[model samples]
Structure formats: structure tokens, C-alpha cells
Target: MSAVLQLLVLVVLAPYLVGLMRQVRALMEGRAGAGIGQPWRDLRKLFRKEPISPDGSSWVFVAAPAVLAATTLVIAAVAPFAATVSPLDGVADLFAVVALLLLGTVALALAGLDTGTAFGGMGASREITVAALAEPTILLAGFALSARVGSTNLAAIVERGNHSPGDLLSPATLLAAVALAVVVIAEAGRLPVDNPSTHLELTMIHEAMVLEYSGRDLALVEFASALRLTVLLGLWVNLFVPWGIATSEAPLALLGGAAVFVVKVAVVGAVLAAGEVFMAKLRLFRVPELLAGSFLFGVLAVSSSFFLA
Candidate 1:
């Protein structure tokens, strides 16, 4: 029941979160911006249009959006967003969650290559490159966090954090948080990594891959992208700031947890958006260096957990 509520909240609130981030960026830039409802309106418009496929595309192209969306939904359902005692808690292993995320990324990369367009191929190459660098940092950070608890289960990590607040301030935890923050930015294709708003062929990483998608396919892709961001941010919050999460199964506790979850995620998203306003995307060749630095932090985190124990 808690898992279902988390999934519903993610599906319904993800778009508005995107809109909120965009609005924050706009406001920072002194623009009035479109209202927060704009993303929902854009999604509705996209769903009403007829989907079109590229002439040479195969089943991979037709299935990538659904595959991507399905993987994200799975993560949202099993992850400890609102409550620590979810029905699917047994399956919420950190490695499994990371693998599911990579599966969606690989599916979309394959779809990009399947399109046979030069831009698609280029984007696929870049996306895979970024994923290769970003995903490992996520694993290392998760392992660092899980080391103290002796279990890779995400619920165990969060529940432990809730019960032991001092762990959140440890050297290992702080280092892992910094590493994962960079991973989230890279994985979500945000600025200083890949500009989500860019359309230029030379600069596009994620956008180039989906250039051929239209109508319902486009809507699914966009929504999945938004949900992925929300899931990543939510996971980060629950892992590092598990104070407000419900540890029990009571209805009131679950409701309060859900409300707190939204507020935390929104605050992080707004901060990220505001930060991006003052930053510029890194040169393509330099992105690997940034990710490599994050990976180093993950390594340091692991070392800190062992030595500082």
C-alpha cells in the first residue's frame, strides 16, 4: 500500500517538479516564465498528437519508451520514498536499483542506434559514455552507505539512518552524498554535464537520441525522463536525509511521510535549478574528467567507511 502510494505520487508529481525547476531557473534569470502547469499541458498536447516513426526504425524504436518508463516505474515502486516498510522492501537492493536504472539507459541507447540517423548514433555514443562513468559512482556510493549496515538493501540503509542520525554526519556519508550529487546531475543530463534544453546537434546528448520520436512516444519519453529525475533525487534524499520518512505502517505516518518526501525533493530540485542558472555546460571532452572526480570521491567514501570505523 505504501509502495502504491509512492508510485502514484511520483507519476503525478514528477512533471510538476520539472515545471518547478524550470520556473526557478526562469525566475533566477529574471523571466516571468510559464506557470508550473506548463509541463502538464505540454504532456497532454503531446499525447493527443499522432505518433510517427522513422522509416528505417525497428521494434527497438517502438519499444524503448515503454521499456524506459517501465524500469522507472519499478524503481519508484520499490524504492523507499515515503515509507521504510514497503511491501517490496525485500527487493530494494541498492545494486538491483542501480542495475534497473542502467537497463533503462541501455534500452534507450539501443533505440538510438536502431534509428540509423547520424545524430542518433552520436547521441547514443555520448549517452553510453556518460552512463559508463556515472553508474559506477552510484554503485560505489551505495556500497559505502551500505557498508556500515552490512546489507545492500535501501530500506535497511534508510531505516538505519532514521534511527541513527549521527551516521548522516559521518565522513563516509558526507563523501558519498557529494559523489551521488554529481552522479544525479550527470544521469539526469542536467547542466555542466549535458544541457537538457539544448537542441544543437553538436551539443546534444540525450535529446539527439529521441529526435525521431513524436506524439505519444514523445510524451512517454518526456514523462519517463521527468520520473527518472524525481526517482534519483528522491533516492538521494531518503538515503542521506531519512529523518522525515515513515518507519512504521500507520496511515497517518505514511501520509506525513509522503508530504515530507515531496517537499524535500522539490527543495533539492529548486536548488539544482538555481545552481544551473549560474553554470554552463562543460566541454564534451571534459565531462569524463568531472565524472572521474566524482568516482574518486566514491572511492574516498569507501576508504573512509573502513578506516574511520
Candidate 2:
């Protein structure tokens, strides 16, 4: 029941989260932004339009959006968001969760290549490169968190943190938080890594792959992207700041937990958007350096868990 609530919450709140971020950025830039309902309106319009496919595209192109959306849904369902306990806890291993994320990424990359467009190929190559670097840091950071719990299950880690508040302030936890935060920014294609709002061919990492998608296809892709950002932020919140999460399965507790989860994700998303306003995307070649630095933090986090703990 908690898991179902989480899935529904993410689906409904993801677009609003994106809108909140955009509103924050626009406010920071001294402009009156579109209201927070704009993303929902856009998705509604897209769904009503006819979808078009590129002439040479195959099944891969037709399926990638669904595959990506499916993976995001799975993760959102199993992950400990509003509640620490979930019916699918057994499958919510950190490694499995990360693998599911990569599966979606790979599916989209394959679709990009399937398009046979130069921009598609270029974007796929860049996306894969970023994923290769980002995914490992996510694993290492997860490992750092799991060391104290002795289980790779994400629920176990969050449950342990909720029970041991001091653990959140430990050297290992702090380091892993920073590392995972960087990976989240990179994985979400935010500023200083890749610009989510840009279409400049030289800087397009995610947008290029879906250049041929229109109508319903584009809606699914966009929704999946927004959901990815929300899920990642929600996971970070529950992992590091598990205070408001329900440890029990009571109805009232679940409701409060869901409300708190929404607030925390919205705050984090707004902060990220505001930060992006003052930053510029890194040069393509320089992206590896930033990722490498995060990787180093992951390594240090692992070491800290063993030594500092």
C-alpha cells in the first residue's frame, strides 16, 4: 500500500517539481515565470497530439520511451520514499536499483543509435560516457552507506539511518552524500554537467537522442525524465534525511511521510534550480574531470566508512 502510494505520488508530483524548479530559476533571474502547472499543461497537450516516428526507425525507437518510463516506475514503486517499509523491499537492493536506472539509460541510448542520425549518435555516445562515470559513483556511495547496515537493500540502509541519527553526521555519510549529490546532478543532466534546457548540438547530451520524437512519444520521454529527477531527489532525501519517513505501515504515518517527502524533494529541486542559474555548463572535455572528482569522493567515502566508523 505504501509502495503504491509512492508510485502515485511520484507520477503526480514529478511534473510539478520540475515546474517549481523552473519558477525558482525564473524568479532568480528577475522574470515572472509560467505558473507551476505549465508542465502538466504541456504534457496534456502532447498526449492529445499525434505521435510521429522517423522513417528509418525500428522497434527500438518505438519502445524506448515506454521502457524508460517503466524502469522509472519500478524504481519509484520499490524504493523507500514515503515509508521505510515496502512490499517490494526484497528487490530494492542498491545494486538492483542502480542497474534498473542503467537499464533505462541503455534503452534510450540504443534508441538513439537506432535513429541513425548524427545528433542521435553523438548524444548516445555522450550519455553513455556520463552514465559510465556516474553509475559507479552511485554504487560506491551506496556501498559506503551499506557498510554499516551490512545489507545492500535500500530499505535497510534508510531504516538503519532512521534508527541511528548520528550515522547521518559521520564522515563516511557526509562524504557519500556529497559524492551522491554530484552524481545526481550529473545523472539528471543539470548545470555544470549537461544543460537540460539547451539544444545546442555541441552541448546536447539528452535532447539530441529524442530529436525525432513528437507528440505522445515526446510526452512519455519528458515525463520519464522529470520522474527520474524526482525519484533521484526523493531517494537522496530518504537516505540522508529519513526523519519524516514512516517506519511503520499505519495509514496516518504514511500520509504524513508522503507529505514530508514531497516538501523535501521540492526544496531540494528548488535549490538545485537556483544554483544552476549562477552556473554554466562545463566544456564537453571538462565533464570527465568533474565526474572523476566525484568518483574520488566515492572512493574516499568507502575508505572513511571503514576507518572512521
Candidate 3:
């Protein structure tokens, strides 16, 4: 029951989260911008249209969106979103979750190349480059956080955290939080790494790769992209701040937990929106440097745990 609720929230609320971010950005910039329902409308419009594939594109192009969205849904289910325990915890480990996300990334990258367009190839190259740099930071950062509970399984980490929340304020925790925050920006294709609203092929990382997709395919891809951001942010929040998460499967606790989870994610959404307002997108060549700095933070986080904690 908790698993079902978790999955539903991830799927149904993911687009709304994206819309909220846009609205937040819009208000910060002093423009009304698109309303909070814009993403939902966009998805509905895309699904109602016809899907077209690029010439010579293989089945991978057609299948990448499903794979991406499915993997994201899987991650959300396995993680303890609104509950301290997960219905799918048996298959959910920190390492396994990260690997599943990487699988989706690889599939999309291959699909980008399969399109045989220069923009597709360019996007794939840039996305893969960032993925390679970001992957290490993810592993190291997760390790830093997991080290406190002495486990790499996310459920275990969250469960242990319920018993012991003191470590969340330690130097190691702060370092890991900073590292993961940087990763979230890069992984989710946010500003300073990549812009979701941009059409400039030369500067686009994620949008460029999916430029050839249309209709349902594009809807799935865009929905998956939004889901990706939502899941990653939720996971980070649950990891760093496990407050209000129900440790039981009781109905009331689930309700309370769900409400708290939404509030927490909304707060995070606003912070991310405000953050992008202050920073401009970095040059493509300088992206690696930003990722490298994140890697350093992750390493320091791990080392601090060993030496200081």
C-alpha cells in the first residue's frame, strides 16, 4: 500500500513539481510566466498528437522514453519516500539505485546517437561527459552519507536515521549535502549545468538529444525528465532530512508522511528556482571543472567521515 502510494505521488506529482519550479522562477524574475499547470497541459497536448521518429532511427529511439520513465518510477518505489519502510526495499540499494539511473542515461544517450543528427550526437557527447564526471561524485557522496549507518542500502540508511538523526548535522553530512546538491543541478539539467528551457543546440545538453522526438514519445521523454528531477530531489531530501517520514505502514502515518513529503519537496523546489536565478549557465568547456569541484567535495566528505566522525 505504501509502495502504491509512493509510486502514485511520483508519477502524478512529478509534472506539478516541474510546473511549480517554473512558476517559482517566473515570479522571481518578476514575470507571471506559465501557470503551475503548464507542464500537465504540455504533456496532455503531446500525448494527443502523433509521434514521429527520425529516419533510420532504430527501436532504441522508440523505447528510450519508456525505459527512462520506468527506471525513474522504479527508483521512486524502492526509496522510502513517505514511509520509513519500503514495499520494494528488497531490491533497493543505494548502489543499485544509482546504477538504474545510469542505465536510463545510457539508453537515452544511445538513442541520441541513433538519431544520426549532428545535434543528437553533440547532445549525447555532452550528456555522457557530464554523466561520467557526475557518476563518481554520486557514488562517493552516497557513500559518505551511508557510512554513518554502516550500510549502502537506502532503506537501511533511512531506517537507521530514524533511530539516530544526530549524524545529519555532522561535517560529513554537510559535505555530502553540498556535493549532492551540485550533482542534482547537473543530473537534472538545471541552470549552471544545462538549461531545460533553452533551444540553442550549441549550449543544450538534454534538450538537444530529444529534439527529434514528437508526440507520445516526446511526452514520455519530457515526463521522464521531470520525474528524474523529482525523484532525485526527493531522495536527497529523504536522505538529509528524514523528519516527518512515517516509520510505520499505518494509514494515518502514511497520510501525515505524504503531506510532509509534499511540503518538503515544495520548499526544495523554491530553493532550486531561486538558486538558478542567481547563477548563469556555465560555458560548455567549464562544465567539467564544476563537476570536478563537486567530486572534490564528495571525496572530502568521505574522508572527513573516516577521520572526523
Candidate 4:
């Protein structure tokens, strides 16, 4: 398959995965749930509705989701989906990927603050505070894997892992993966960090920031958030466990690779949803402590990588 086609698949399927996870969560909670296609319907409904922005808000509120979605789509295009292949592989550096991802997060947080609502300001402040610490953990943990593999490019790391899946069990790899998993939960606004389902003023972090967005603006932001979650989960699966990802251009191999990719992502999403189901939301103040533990784990993982290498 062509890289362009693969990118299109990612762009289209990312939201479906988020919706599926929500469906799974709803089932687990014993509620009749919206199907996986519900998000698409929600997006359509949102786009047809009239937008209502805050009077205090600037263009930032309108522009944030476009910037975020564009950046995230580009980042997804560059990340290795099937072995060493990437749509933007020629320029794929893991550090640059991490930076691009963070850029979107920072932009959205700034947009939240630009609204000048109390919830917006509070959300932005807390978001950035958590982000300031989480970003380094992401870089360092991924860097540890890159250091061991001899390339900071995600494609190269996956190439190496595909040839040696056992390496995923290494102390450094395990530590990095575990730390990255925790960071993913925090980064994606899952439970034990932030809750997406909550409307309570005091406990919400991500939802609080977008209280001012409505219609298409809100839809875009929510869709972008779900896409970001899918992207991060894809990165985790691609980097740590890449056994069946395509390394050859053969059609059969590519088909197999794509199947493996879907299975891996589905299992990861299910585990994440289950974790959310079993856990309660953390307090606002305790969020910092939870993220701090992830940071410490990431630091240890990085240190172990250098020491072992």
C-alpha cells in the first residue's frame, strides 16, 4: 500500500478507535452504550450546529483545534505504522515527533487560557504544569529505547524491535514501556490522572479547558483529543512490540502487518479502558503526585538504559 493511503487510513480510523473504547467502557459499566460509530455522528451533529465562542476569547479559540489536528496528523504520518515504513519516513526523528506532539498540547492549553473563563484559566494552568513534567519523561523514556537501538528515529527503533521482539523484555525496555504507559494515561486524560466523563468543576482537567467551545469548535477539539489518544497508543505499540509490523513490501506481508497492527492497538485500548473502569479519578492536587511518580519512573528507565548500555 502507498504511504498516502496508509496516512488516510490513520486519519479516518483514529476516531473510530476512541469511540470503540468508549463503547467498551460503557458496556463494562453495565450501560447500553453508543456504538463505535457514534463519534462520527457526534462530529457531524457538531459541525452542523452554530458555533458560539466567548466574547472574551480571541481567534486562538477558533484556531487551536485546526492547529492541533494538523500537527497531530503530521506526527502520525511520520511515526512508523508498519516496521521501518513511514509516510514521512525520510524526516522521521523520534525527538522531532515528540516535539511536534508537545507543540499541539501547548497550543491547546494556550487556547484554553485565551478564553479567560475561570475554568479555562484553571485548566490551562494545571494542564501546563502537568505537561511541563510529562514531556521530559516521554523524551527520556523514548530516548532510552533509541539509545539502546542506536537511532532516535522511530522507524529505526521499530525495525530493530521487529527483528528482536525479545528485546522488549529487557530491563530498560520494560521500564521505558511501563513509564511510557503511565505517561500515556496522564497525557490522554484517562482515569487516575484526569477523567473525560466528569463534569464536576473541581475534578476536571481536560474537559474544563473546553467549556467555552461549542458546535464545530467543540467537536474539533474533542475529536482532536481522541485522535491524540489513538496516536499515542499507536506509538507505544509500534515502539515496544513490533513483531508483525511490515518490513518487506510484499502484499501478503503488508496484509498480515496491518492485521497485527489492529490487534495490537485493540488490545492496548481494551487494557486502557479496563484500567479506567476499575479506577476512580484522582483529586486535583494529587494529579501532580501521580505525574511525578511517572517522571521518576521515566528517569530511572533512562538511567538504566545508559548504565546497561
Give the per-residue lDDT of model 2 (tens digit) for 1-309. 999998999999999999999999999999999989899999999999999998899999999999999999999999999998877999899988999999999999999999999999999999999999999999999999999999999999999999999999999999999999999999888999988888999998999998989999999999999999999999898899998899889999999999999999999999899999999989999999999999999999999999887
Worst 10 residues of 3 by lDDT: 84-93
lDDT of 4 by residue, 1-309 (tens): 535544665667777888888888999999889898898888989989888988877888889888888888887667777546644676778778878878888888988899888898888888888788788889888878887678788888888888887777878888888889888888888888888888888888888888988998888887788878888888899888887888876777766776787788878998888778899988878888877887788888888888886
Worst 10 residues of 2 by lDDT: 82-91
Instruction: Output the lDDT of residue 142, model 1.
Output: 93
Between prediction 1 and prediction 4, the one with superior lDDT is 1
Tell me the lDDT of model 2 at 44.
100
Model 4 scores what on Cα lDDT? Answer: 0.82
User: Tens digits of per-residue lDDT for model 1 on 183-231?
Assistant: 9999999999999987988898999999999999999999999999999
* CA error at residue 134 for candidate 1, angstroms: 0.9
- Backbone clashes in model 4: 0
> Mind giving the per-residue lDDT tens digits that candidate 3 earns over 1-309?
888888888888889999999999999999988988899999999999999998999999999999999999889887888886766886778888889889999989999999999999999999999999998999999899878778888878777766778888889888999998999889999999999988996799999899999999999999999999989899889888888988889999988888898899989988998888998999999999999999999999999988997
Q: TM-scores of the models, in the given order?
A: 0.99, 0.99, 0.98, 0.95
lDDT of each: 0.95, 0.94, 0.90, 0.82
lDDT of 2: 0.94
Better of 1 and 4 by TM-score: 1
How far does residue 236 in candidate 4 sit from its true spot (Å)? 0.6
